[model samples]
Target chain A: MYASRTTQFIVGLFALLGIAALAILSFRLGKISILPTPGYVIYANFDNISGLKPGDEVDIAGVRIGKVLGASLSDNQARVAMEIDKGVQIDNDAIASILSMGIIGGKYVSIQLGGGDKTLSNGDIIRQTQSAFVLENAIGQFINNIGQSGGSKDSSSSQDSQQSQQKK
Target chain B: MQVVEFIERVGAYILDSILALGNFALFLIRSLMYAVLPPYKLRLTLRQIRIIGAESLMLIVLISTFTGMVLGLQGYHTLHLFGAEDSLGTLVGLALVRELGPVLAALMIAARAGSAMAAELGSMQASEQIDALTVMAINPVQYLVSPRMIAGVVSFPILTVIFNVIGIWAGYAVGCGLLGASGGAYFNNLAANMSRHDVALTLYKALVFGVVVMSVCCYKGYHAKRMATGVSRATTEAVVLSSVLVLAWDYFMGSILL
Candidate 1:
């Protein structure tokens, strides 16, 4: 009963505003791209990926050049696929390393450009790859070394004291 | 004898609650069926949208802007201790997009439009207008309830998107402008962390909240007692019940969707 030309106009405007808002949320804020930018895929194998996940940034000399596509395990090694932007060229001897953003931040792939003549193309694997440095493992190793050396030194000193006591 | 009486009362209460639940379910089904059937009530739906969505837009905007600013201030202070104030955008954006935006917007609408719906329908029922429609061979549920339901479902997601966009910008203003955080880091972190899944979750929650809010409000009003204070009582009950249900369903959906 309240329907009128003015109401219709306002409703139309409201609908349009809502649509525009939705568009901004989806495309700009959410960063949902309808068309995937032109890119080529490359693969690297790591002994351990740690917690590197898909969508992690792939960087070259501190600059992002691609993103991790996915990670899989084959032949007891972690195989990671990265989607590199088309224009960036990767040398045959390039190295890919899994690095963290900060001390407690998320993991990402870093590429080191090599001075090789041959340029790797799509589907080529980077031969030199470094795995993620797990903090817990490093700490464990450090503690183990300390324990071993400390025990040996303490035992050796006690044995010399025992020999001196016997001589006395 | 007392024990027997207590048992009888408990059984009666259980039976009554079950019956009420069944009635509500059937009411929702009928409203949905009418909503999708032929002879669409586009005009009435538009009018209801104007009442529920457009009229409430300003309120939603005001609440959302403040909410975003508060989030930014709080996030910046907390993250500043850890030297990560730059992540303010990510924190604010994710929190609003994932949880606050849909839930708060729906609650606001429930407070504004849902109470009005209940009062209107309750008064109409008290005056026997619904019965008159039925007597005239017109379906009152189709004529009144279905259009409101359609409008609720359509308007809620739209309003939620608007709320999110405004809230994020407001947060950006506080974070970058007032707090002196780097604008690039704020937006870069936000863009990197946000994904389509988060956006989908926002819209999905809005849709479900819309269904819940409309159903509870309409159900309460449609069956409100035909008495002097019935309209006021129904309106109060509609607002309370819809708000609670919106929150409860939001938690349930969030657990599942996330």
Candidate 2:
């Protein structure tokens, strides 16, 4: 029952349209690359990665240069493997820090370019790295300090009252 | 005696359902075997694609756009409560690409093309056309069922991709255009949060839903009783069963994939 040429043409058109839509979803929206971008791998060790994930961005001074490939435990620290684009050269003494995108956003690795003359090559480990800031840890430390100071003040006030009573 | 009769009736009902399930499994396996075998009916498959895929395109586009727009509106209001309106894009994108796009598109196609498949095949069975094909030394399953199955498997993912793309853009139009959320944050969060895994999930769900829809609809119609009332009943059963199967399979896949 497939007699009409018009139907055949429309079918072909529809197939092409579907393929085009798939291409857009895969490449544009999904950001999937068939061929991995030409890049070199480097390693950085952090004490805590916080909420940083493997697919998070690796940036140099607010400019995204690559992506985090994966993270694993190495020598009691989080060893993160990052794929940096070939053109961008990271200095040997550069500092890598985990920075959040916003108040309630994802974490990314940011590199502060170092003044060292030698540049890091593939497989080089960045020695200077900063771990992600844990908000809970900071709050806990603050509360502990407050508690200690309050207890010490109360003890000193009691000691002063006892001395006055003894003198009287 | 009355209690024994009731127990016997329940046992018979359970056995009847088990037999029906076995029949469905065998029918699906036979159709799949025909689909993969050589001497592929490319012309008939194309015709089925034109009917199932091309005809449903406009309906998919319209439904997806509205769905996206609604997601954007709802997401903005909800996230705005936490002062996270900028995440509207991420919410819309993830919701559509991961879940709504495939499921909703499958349901729509099930309602539109799936019902048509059932009614057409049911009527054909009632009219003795299927018998005539069998008598003419042609395998009715291969000639009729395989092509439609192939069409469904091909069409579902394509329609889902179209749904996701259009839906996300429509969400952007509502969230950024109407709600005045920062366009950059919306898109940036989407890009940052979404991954290849999410996109793959969308396509996978579409593929499974496609198979479920085609098998259920075709099975019901193929075994339809030889009567006018039987054809109508088969059509109704096919639509309801396929839609329900699509949803049920979606839940299973989601849990497994996650």
Model 1's chain B yields a TM-score of: 0.98
Give per-model TM-scores.
Answer: 0.88, 0.89
Clashing pairs in 2: none
How well docked is model 2, in DockQ terms? Answer: 0.40
Of the native A-B interface contacts, what share survives in model 1?
A: 0.53
- Interface RMS for model 2: 1.9
Model 2, A1-168: lDDT tens per residue?
672676688789888888898788777766667796788999988878989987788889777688888999988888999999889999987889898765666788999998878999999988888778767766665576577765776555543432211111
The TM-scores that each candidate's chain B achieves against the reference are: 0.98, 0.98
Which 10 residues in a row give candidate 2 chain A its minimum summed lDDT?
Answer: A159-168
Residue-level lDDT of model 2, residues B1-258, one tens digit each, is 999999999999999999999999988888889999987988888888889888999999999999999999999888887677767878999999988999999999988998888888888999999999999999999999998899999999989999999999999999999988888767767776788888889998998888889988998888889976988888889989988888888888889887
Model 1 alpha-carbon drift over 4 Å, by segment = A142-168
User: Which pairs of residues collide in candidate 1?
Assistant: none
Error of 1 at B155 (Å): 0.8
